[model samples]
Target: MIFPTPEEYTVLVLSLKVGLLCVVISLPFAVLLGWVLARKNFRGKLILDGLCHLPLVLPPVVVGYLLLLLLGRRGFLGQILNDWFGLQIAFTWRGAVLAAAVVGFPLMLRAVRLAIESVDPRLERAARTLGANPLRAFFSITLRLAAPGVLVGSLLAFARSLGEFGATITFVSNIAGETRTLPLAIFTYINQPDGEAAAARLVLLSIILSLGALIASEAIARKMKT
Candidate 1:
């Protein structure tokens, strides 16, 4: 296939950038949450699990709205952040990253939790009995054992972020250079006169990217199982 046009190329790159940033920012926290959910039997565990998976079942638009209420210019945290740190997140690429992260987080978190659960706890305990600290055993044993799931989760999150539309558009307003990811660009094209051709091209791109990411994820999962 011919390369995408300069404008289409920009949107493509932006989608990747936003998706990767989302995963990078959220992965650490997702890993921690996944480990906690998998290993711990604490009070409120049910509530915590529900909250971790909330985005998976909630409407994407509602998630975006909730984010806006927390991070908008006049929002409570938003006002504090702006006044104290001069940091602005809403309506920027940073906000796009935040939107993608929130929407994609549950997928990553679930993948991690399942991966950790599949590991035999005895492996980590053996390491602990051999003089490894809990943290060391986790890093050397449980974490390594769960690497495949973490990889799959990362790819899945990347795919989800690439296709993210409702939350991203609702939060960031699709400014061309700053926040117009592939999905936003596709949406713009579909609504314009004689824009179907361009929209079709982007839609094709989206399908290709999604399939590629999932294929890689499946490959990793299969490799890990072997």
Candidate 2:
């Protein structure tokens, strides 16, 4: 398409916002969990890892329903959040972010864990011998070397969020200017009478955005290797 309609622009901007927020909000946790899973051998570690990756195996609709049960307005934790912080996640843009984050988290965590695992443990220990503490060694050596994987994971999460649909729809209900991301917008257009043109535009936009991210990821990976 040459130019996007205002609605298309809004959907594009909202999708970008959700995708970026998903990565920002989830990255720290992914990094920590990845580090733990890669470096530690604690009790129930396998269970924890499985739980972290559960979203990957479960249906996206099921994941959204679970979130709704936990964070919906009348939900148990949702009630507490609403009463304490005036936060309402269900049927809102914030819920969209949460849904995208949950769905994308497993990919993020797996990439980070594999990346950290690829780093040599002896290098961390060697830093310890040179007066670096664990955190210092990790920040300076281990994490630095793992930057490529982290970049890849972040891009993967962002791409996943951009295309997220079932979970977002179930959790946020596809309100325009709120929860209507690109995928949701496309779904809306597809269902409306004589909306094929709009839907086609969105589908093309989705392909372009996803392809751009993939290309950027590949370029970054290549740069990191050299």
Candidate 3:
């Protein structure tokens, strides 16, 4: 019977929406990069790997700032978007998705890449020898085997996005019902007078949700293996 207030519900819903959107939008690229990193070795591979993982090491605020520089109104691509389509991603929900995606991308890529790498290369080669084309074998065997790892990565990304506060607030300015997600709402409550009780409730909820996601991810991984 422990439920958040109506306003807390809004924040919860918004966080889920943004997190799902982030995962959906980033799935394709994550797969492509995962495949390439796991199977191919080319010149500048290290550079590509570093770029994919840079967000993990950098501060979330720094990631948000870089996004602002690239997507803001006065930014390079931002100017093009503004002039051609009148589109603005900064300080918006879309920007929050972008922030979450940037921050969580490495985790997704790591999971998928490891899964792809763990598969036996000889199986793919054998399938090709058995008359399946490279593409066909890959789609049928490699991707199918890696599905579970990718699923785990996606859930991790979702959990990370749900808690995305620093980058989202930095890029989107914490507008209530717009950019203020669960974590941001929790922070707001903690800063207000006599707000500890509400903040404690939200903290418990956040922990529960995050732990549930991790457990689900592990279960899925096990199912995929069998």
lDDT of each: 0.92, 0.95, 0.90
- The reply for model 2, stretches above 4 Å from the true place, is none
lDDT of 1 by residue, 188-208 (tens): 999999999999999999999
Q: Which segments of model 1 are wrong by more than 4 Å?
A: none
Clashes of each: 0, 0, 0
Q: Taking the tens digit of each residue's C-alpha lDDT, what string does model 3 give over 73-188?
A: 99999889989998989998889999999999998999889989988988899899999998999989888888998899899899989888778888887899988888998899
By TM-score, who's the top model here?
2
TM-score of every candidate: 0.96, 0.98, 0.95
Candidate 2 TM-score over all chains jointly: 0.98
What order do candidates take by lDDT, descending? 2, 1, 3
Model 2, span 1-226: residue lDDT tens: 5899898999999999999999999999999999999999999998999999999989999999999999998899999999999999999999999999999999999999999999999999999999999999999999999989999999999999999999999999989999999999999989999999999989999999999998998899889989
Worst 10 residues of 1 by lDDT: 165-174
Query: Can you tell me which runs of candidate 3 are displaced by over 4 Å?
Result: none
Q: For each candidate in turn, give its C-alpha RMSD to the true structure in angstroms.
A: 1.2, 0.8, 1.4
